[model samples]
Target: MKQTGVAILGAGRWGKHLVRNFLAHPDACLVAVVDPYPETLAAIKDKYNLAPEVRLATDWESIRDLPTIEAVVIATPAVTHYTIIKDALNQGKHVLAEKPLTLDVAECLELCHLAQENQRQLMVDHTYLFHPAVKRAQEVVHSGCLGDLRYGYAARTNLGPVRQDVDSLWDLAIHDIAIFNHCLGQLPVQVQANGRVWLQFQKEFQVSQLPVEKEFQVSQLPVESSEDNQGCSQSLTPQQPANLPYGNAKGEQPANLQPANLQPSTPQPSTPQGLADLVQLTLSYPTGFQAFIHLCWLNPDKQRRLGIVGTQGTLIFDEMVAQAPLTIQHGYFEQNGSTLSLLVNIVKFLISNHLNHFIQYAIAFLTVSACPNLHQYLLVWVGAQLVQILSCLSQSLHQGGVPVTVPQLPK
Candidate 1:
């Protein structure tokens, strides 16, 4: 079996996962790893027990010219995707990049053009698309079981792992955005976003421990309207106020918020510039379908779930605690009818669906309990999906860049 030689461009948290998957894949050879941080490189090398033949470099240039490396997986920062992808494509290598493709549509288009010009496969790692739960949800949607998709709600939130490079939208919401596009079979025609900067620094940094500064903290800063509010309202046709503040619907600051005072000689802590810790987005699709995404880095509990409401019924893809991840509840209520009839139908729908769901849940739990390696099975399932994506990219490249289909917002 011929193997496609692949190099990884990052060795951070998610990057390391890619490295493991690539190493485990039989059709791919992990030829190199490129990261500027020595600790990361050392850790990956030690963890993988990388042989001397597998090159380890501090920069992409070292492996870009290597003939053995036919492809590159980019798990770097969003801001650097365009440049790295361009360089990799220029080197005649197929590229698989992490999501949000690029911060700008023009950059994404340019990368697509470069891939076409170079006859190399260019794909984004929209990992959720390959998840069993998301795939099942897509199946349910496309099967028309959830008749006439009306709207979707996706929530992806966590307490920490806050990043400085990108806001919550780009960091977390991008996953659901891709998932929404996948499930709906189309991208949004318009997007409206509202966000706030909550924790400017890491949680461990205490206000009392910090040298007092005269500058007001972000929490104490007065709320202001987002610059995009007016345009977003007009373009996206938002039902709610486009400029609403993060934690409050009324846009009022917390009552306990107070300004910080410090000495002139106090050392200032570095905070991310123009990055939001919480973001809410409304995406309107051409098919009259709407999607609401709520992203936060300050939540007490982690959540990864998506709910789709349709004319027929509602489907919830709760990735966190769900046994099957995809749960379908059948039947809908009629708004215009006799009050007694409406009440009877509602009661019947609830009783029938709840009883059916309980039976399914019980069976699912028993099956899972019977399988000792269920967790490992899930891991392999995910890995198989990744391998399938790689196979598609390699085949596409062999077919002279057949133009891999990607989700694109309607223009």
Candidate 2:
């Protein structure tokens, strides 16, 4: 087997982790570590005890044209992703970028076109899509075990770790969104969101902020629009659901399921804050399934929860809940109107494999050596779907929670 030559750009908080992993992988030959901060590079080199053959550089230009560097793992800020990734893909080097591929949808589309043109791999670091629990949840959701799926909800909240570059919605929301899209096997046809702003644009801060998140807090999941999936409308061209971000290597779309209609909602003013300290969103799918999402950084009680209510039971994924990370609460007893007697047992799916999600992602990346088409796998498609969703949701959030339609991606 031939080794894939790789270069890791940015040796910061996340970049260092990539250095450690690539050093251990049997198929990856880490050729260089690039970052503007020299001290950070020195620390990683000393910490990892990198081989002498590895090169260190202050900028990508020094190594951009190097033939030995076949791939680049970028962990830089999102704002800088387009330039670096564009260069890498153009140079015929495969790329593995951090999440939210770019700040906008246009750039992602352009890069997707470039990757195809060059036949170079471009993947995102959406590790949650490869999570053991999420993988199981996807199988369960698509297997029809849940019976007529009713609706869904998820919350990704924590206390601190905010970033100024992007807002809480942009920073945190992609993870849970990726999970929902993966499990449900469909993209939200429309989304509606409203937020409250406090720390970012209050008496002390400026009001000229765009999509704010005080620190770097990324809310887990969302596809929320309208009230309980009402008020939004769409005339379906009757197309197959967009490809799941983590679908098969050939980029196959989901089963041919008839999608729902999307009605547009008037943009209405929700209580005006600055950048929302909290956000409430709803996602309406083609199958008429709706999902409500709660996002916030001010809440002290941290939570990572998502669930799908079905005719049989509710399948849940609560990351904070240690004992039973994934479970199903059967509503087997009896039901009266909306109320139900839940005198039933809960089914737990404890992930026994101790391998971390990133490790799993790395294994997938390495597999690209044998399977070139693997680039079209998981994060590549998932990242695009997420960026598109986030881009659409941003409009709804800024316009005071009007339902906005999510456009279909090119197949």
The lDDT per prediction is: 0.55, 0.67
For model 1, how does the per-residue alpha-carbon lDDT over 97-207 read when each residue is reduced to its tens digit? 665465555566567667657776666655565566665677778999767888999888765444433445545665676678677766555556655554443322121
Poorest 10 consecutive residues of model 2 by lDDT? 227-236
Q: Could you tell me how far off, in angstroms, the CA of residue 90 lies in candidate 2 after the best superposition?
A: 0.9
Q: How close is candidate 1 to the true structure, as a TM-score?
A: 0.64
Q: Which lDDT tens digits does candidate 2 get at residues 1-411? A: 688889987775566667877888877788998866566678878999988889998778888888899888877656567778898888888888877687777788889889878887778877766667877788888888777899999997766443343455776677777778878878999998887665444222221233211122224422221111000011111231222111001111123321221111232245433445577889999999998888876566677899998887788898777656899776554878988677656889877542355655665564464334224444366677888998777778877788999999985
Q: Candidate 1: where are CA atoms >4 Å away?
A: 201-273, 334-411
Measured against the true structure, the TM-scores of the candidates, in listed sequence, are 0.64, 0.79
Instruction: Identify the candidate with maximal lDDT.
Output: 2
Look at candidate 1 and tell me the lDDT of residue 244: 20
- Residue 12 in model 2: shift from native, Å? 2.1
User: What residue pairs are clashing in model 1?
Assistant: 212-262, 213-262, 214-262
